[model samples]
Target chain A: MSSFDRNDRPLVDVRHLKQYFNITVGPLRTKALKAVDDVSFSIRSGETLGLVGESGCGKTTVGRSILHLYQPTGGEVEFEGRLIKTKSDINELRKKATMVFQDPYSSLNPRMTVSDIIGEPLDIHKMYANKAERMERILELMDRVGLNSEHASRYAHEFSGGQRQRIGIARALALRPEFIVCDEPVSALDVSIQAQVINMFVELQEQMGLTYLFIAHDILVVRHISDRIAVMYLGKMVELADASVIYDQPLHPYTRSLMSAVPQPDPKVARANKRIVLSGDIPSPLNAPSGCPFRTRCPHAAPCCAEAMPEFKEVESGHFVACHRVNEL
Target chain B: MNKRFTMHIDVDAFLPATDEEKAYMVQMRPSSTFFRDGVKRLLKNKVATVSLIIILIITLSSLIIPAFWPYSYESMLGVRPGKSVDASFNNLSPFEYGETEQARIAAGETVFPHIFGTDSSGRDYFIRVIYGTRISLAVGFFASLIVLIIGMTIGSIAGYCGGKVDLIIMRFVDMIYSLPDMLMVILLATVLKQTLAPVLEGTSLARIGVNIISLFVVFGVLYWVSMSRLIRGQILSLREQEYVLAAKAAGAKGGWIIRKHLLPNCISVVVISTALQIPSAIFTESFLSFVGLGVNAPMPSLGSLASDALNGLSSYPYRMVIPAVVISLIVLSLNLFGDGLRDAFDPKLRT
Candidate 1:
């Protein structure tokens, strides 16, 4: 599975990434909460891989771990063919890979002016010749993100949510990164403004030849921008396929149920669509089930499902699923 | 591939008529820094503005008036070399003339009237009050500065470096908090006065008195706990903000992040806390001075003057009333100003 032809090298390759948070449940009792367990994926250059999951399914953790925002408890992240194993390697990777956080309100420093917030990365890297050059570059970035030069001196709180997200994007783009983990960048935005911000993201990618690990819970939003989509169940990846393939013909029962839940715009299609609501709450990661983490809630659970976890294996070209009943289906 | 969709519309109609109109489309408000904006809001608050003015007037008079005043705070008005003390000059009421001054007035020689009366020692009461205001204001400001420096340093360090460092510093803070503040202050002041008197002898600080030095020491030792705790709480919350993470992700070092991100975000809290601390420091200094542990004799603090007036309280009550009113006025103004600063500068209170 480590085969990458010279012509198709991935920008970021995360293999067997595990992030287990040791939470104190009681006095002197610590339990490991596996937030992202054995999650493996690769993002090709100039492409977007949408990571879709429920709120606690570790989609955000996957993005953060790849960026080394949260140190992974196990496994490796390779950036542009170099294995990131040390602090320096991670720091080097940060120059080329960045993140746009979910909440624009909380993500930006309220005291910082727009220019200072955006120019921070450049200042950190010492990328400019002088103050004049730095200001010019910041203004150029503001213009690229459709912000006026006059907005440069204004603080983050003075802007609307969409505008603040634009400031965040400008900050991310300051280093001229090749890859960015857009962690639900538009989730907190209004429906009317979400499309506009998403469109700007798409335009930025096109202009800069950037790759994105776009993590979002909204499947429809993910499908709109993602070339490939991966669905996670609990802390594990359940399905990986091309966006169109996953939407048109979902193989895993969980993926099928997820697709069925997206409300169709057409009244006839909406009336015809079936909703598959899973039973029982998502089990706590501390006390996860023995075999498959999702087995208890799976509709097609079998005796074999309780014995061992299903291997995430490729079923067809460019499509993968982890299910005990995949062959029978 | 060669097809050109030519849809002709009225493009000229939408164009601006003049360059000014074009510029108007993107006009922006002139930019201002946080400090300037805070000042703008503060100036709009009438009560705080008036209080600030009063404080300024008092401070300026204290600094400038003593230089040109007709009588010295420490000199007896009618005492001279080789002459018996002129008892009639002592305790002259406000706007009253002594025997010598009245004789000079009868001789058609102009005599300066005693303003706010002479003290029992025959020193000018007005000059003493002015000097007292100066000392109290100076102590309040300097003590607050010392507290700010100590508290901000310890708080940021402990908050940023959590776990063992935080625990140790916090326990130390708790120990300080549990101690009886006033009793400790009084004890420290008394002990420090005895020790500092010899060390400060013949130095300029000796003129300010050993008691004032001990009062400052007491403040330095006891008054910084609240400030440190407040700053520590602020830094704890601010260090977790995503901007701090973003700064870290951008390769900022710990000190750099603390300086550029953490401290600035909680600057409103710092300003408000420092402002509020001043009045408490002033009140504490006055209270200590009232108990005879403030500035040395011959240097009247407002509290010491009130203490002295207690001897003649039945006969001349205004002496006590005057200094008490001044102390209340100064503390009340500072507190109201601090409230206004919180209202104006605090981001949490902003719309």
Candidate 2:
């Protein structure tokens, strides 16, 4: 959104991305766990794309697959219009793109000092010419993330959750990456600290002209950061639109229910809001309902809705939905 | 500032923070690394501290005492080339003077008292005990070191690679596991002794003996399985840590990730396992020595000394007691100290 030409090609384009993990069900029998099935989306350069869903809906898988952290079982990921296919391409992609993991405790190497953890990316890419230059860059990164330079030599365990997350952000920023996949970077923090980290992400994006694929289950957080939002259910994307349009005029039944579920802060708005609580728990992806994975829970389900999967198609200029009854609803 | 509310806005309070204020707000803790923290915790444990001290005393004595001792480890005090053995020197009890030594004392000369007395050979039993300690301690440490190097390498490779590599390496480990442990050690020791004797005959290594080298070979071949399995399990879990993934995301290679992230996380396991391994390695060396596969004759390993003491047991039980007590003390102190180190460095046990 920050001065990216509206007509320029998207910085990242995912076409029919599929990620399936094989699990041994028995001694010789194996079954595929379709973690992300036929998900497709695109994010313009200098824009934030928010991916939202409940747990186990493959939102995180989509982020990881784009980074080639998990080799996608099928389809293509295009970065700067180049197909990310070869090992070297993935390595090249890694330099320009990075990720901020979900759990701060598990994300930073526990044995490393704060300086080493933040300097790891620099060391990996050979970014600095000399030791003093490396130290200078490390101090700059730490300051950007609001960490005290004095904390450099201390191990990660000495810091609180918020501070550890700052260290993670510092590492992600060390390579000066253009694209970052933030996999619930703030969900692990307290609500008060979450705001600080999210604001820092925004500030960094503006400062560095960075692009982000922000994946989270927290709808409010996604709404706050995303220029455009995509909703996924059971490894399939249900809707995609501008953040405000999705929140205000959701078309798909699942997206409608998800939107209604957001709590209204004011008593008057709370009384006026109609909460569309779904009937059953989300079915496991391993045995997700055939045709439309959401058909079993869709209130507007018909015989036709269960016979063939709905195609995710654009109805308006920028809004997309995948429901057979988009016209009727 | 209270500008958002209908109240007095303190513009001074809303001013940007200064360097002095930020520095004051930092409240930084003293810088500490993982090793320093582990050591700090280790010193707080009394049992571990005492055990560590006892090990130091024993190790220092074994290393330093032989340099200045009066009698050589193998020199027989009373035998000459053209003369018969001085019969009284052959089996002198503790502090007892031999026939020639008594004559020397009567002639205003001096002889050092045998603290553990003479064995059947008439060599100074005290020096033999000291040399035996040196051999035992050396074997214990060197064997464990070999196991650590081999096991850590194989384990990290197998664990980080996973899949087919993991399957093949793990099967090989299992195959080694199925072998009869004691039989393998004895068989390898005998075979190594036979093969290495001629090759080592003229080398400086001849002083260390073929049997000790065989003991090391046995440990390298068989004893590493447990350490490998331990490190493999540690790596298997640690490789899944997000830091490893983060490194991978930063385009770091598998070897780099294993070295920078996986191995460092499991250092506690390595230290603790190696410490525990020393005692067992020492015990194995002694057991092999007891069965006549220990260090060569005249070298005086604790097990070989004890084995020789069997010939004089009825007349001199203390010879048996002395070497046996030394072995037991070494193993005991090592075991206790290893436990202390584990308690100190283990992440779960960190205070």
Candidate 3:
């Protein structure tokens, strides 16, 4: 496992991942909820890929699916170029990948001490040799995540919201994994706390050479931290490109609108930019449009857009856009 | 605010100590969180505390006192069967002897050493009542344990694993829930008495074992379905928690996940539910015994004593009142204790 190539490659690679939940409507009737429909992306080693989308756009689903939290309906997950197949393979992959959940208040076990919470992953992995080593590791993790070492003995509910989130981060970092799926880790935190946590994530990634799938609804925050950004709308990845290009050029109309929606601190630039309010609510995944899931809400939809779902193709250097009218646009 | 009032409010609102001071506060955790809450709730429930005290006294006296009855319960004392408590039973002096057959008996009927009085058989009613506590407490303790183990194991497995396992386990639990609990206990007890009793005649311990095991099984299996349902509901909610998912993401296996994450979260529910169910289990056992299906003859459980009292209701009302009061007191205390525990452990109800 150690000899596996680590020079310069994607730390985690997910290709065409799909997660569908079957909902029972009546005695015999059933409906497929395509929570994640053929979503694909990759995170290079030491790079942060921010996944920005609305609540139902399958952002969290993508993170969970990538970690095999929800067994994918169909897809391939490659970790460090090794293909994951069986449960054992997934288990092996999980050792190198972990998720920081959206809700800081609930992510940590309320009954557990900070030591136990952070020590859990190590205990599971059997990373430490003895009790003293385990405690030392836990305290080290606490210090790494900006938590005081003395806080290890205290239960999660005893801590403030910010402290809890830090404890959550410490738990995620316990295994010292190369890649982490941060699913809205700071969204439930206070504004001041969110910055501190986000900065801590950046610092840790640099220090540990970690890759991250940073999922959030806040585009500005994502753009600030991400090397590349992926915009998802209703289970479809509309655009994927460098953070600057995604914000400045934003090839897909949906991406452009989302970028425009971010409130610019400069009042003049903010007022001048037209807010592209999506015409209607996001379509339920059950009855998503036949072609191009986003066509129902895209302001620039055409007849071809309804003909069939467009291929997710690289339209320019490293910029992938999945829309029928990409050529026309 | 006055000092006392401020202290009162502070006591209720006291937060768990911070990590910086946990070393100094370690011993105080249980006292502050569990004992403080338990004592406060117990103090609020006056009836439960009174019954608890009575049970404590009964248990202490029964365990420490001598076995011999100072005066027999079945023997006719000076008091005739229907005589008033203030008159024939209490009127005769302990030192006096009867002159004639009728007056001798009447004078002999004096209270004497018969604190609980005599039953129709003339055995000390008080002594039998004290002895009955051992059986009642045993049934309560063991039967509740069996039910808890079955419920926790089945419920946690069903809930944490979910899908078909949950459906099958829960449906079976529902089926059990539909049956009359007492009816099941009787049917099971009857089958055990007929089939196993004869086989166990060779050994004394075996006989006791068969009796107790059958009794425990009868009540345990009958009552566990509700506990299972409770644990499953708790686990269902607990399984969705982030710690469980985090545990999974950490490569923790399913068994380890259940043991470490799911079980700890639901333990409070199981414990409080178990405490509440003990009295029911004991009551169920007693009811079966009273109806001639329970602990058998010579052992003398509260239910069997009450059974005898029921037979001589008109002749010796004391026979019924003593055991009946003891049984009710034990059940009431257990219920109050369960309530106190529930209030202490249940976060939703806690301030």
Best by DockQ: 2
lDDT of 1 by residue, B88-153 (tens): 888989988878889999999987777899989887898998888888999998889889888888
Q: Report the C-alpha lDDT of model 1 over A40-148, residue by residue, as the tens digit.
A: 8788878889999889989988988888888899999999999998989988987999999999999898878999999999988899999999999999999999987
| Model 1 / residue A28 / CA error / Å | 4.2
Candidates in order have lDDT scores of: 0.88, 0.91, 0.79
* TM-score for each candidate, following the candidate numbering: 0.89, 0.94, 0.86
lDDT score of model 3? 0.79
lDDT for each residue of candidate 2 in B198-229, tens digit (9 for 90 to 100): 99998988888888988998999998888889
User: What tens-digit string does per-residue lDDT give for candidate 2 at A1-329?
Assistant: 34443445788999999999998889999899999999888989889999999999999999999999999999999999999999999989999999999999999887899999999989988999999999999999999999989788888988999999999999999999989999999999999999999999988988898999999989999999999999999999999999999999999999999999998889899899999989999998888888899999988899998888999999998898889999999
lDDT of 2: 0.91
Model 1 superposed RMSD (Cα): 5.4
- C-alpha lDDT (0 to 100) for residue B101 of candidate 1: 86
A1-329: candidate 3 lDDT, tens digit per residue: 01222355777888998899999979989999998889787777778889998898899989988888888899888998988888888878877899898887778876677799899989888898899999988888888988878667777776778888888888888888888999998889889988999999888877787888999999878987888899998888989999999989988988888888888899999889999888988898989998988888889998888989989999999899998888877
Best by TM-score: 2
Chain A TM-score for each candidate, in the given order?
A: 0.97, 0.98, 0.96
Native contact fraction of candidate 2?
Answer: 0.79
Task: Judge candidate 3 at residue B33 and give its lDDT.
Answer: 36
TM-score of chain B of 3: 0.74
Give the CAPRI rating of model 2: medium
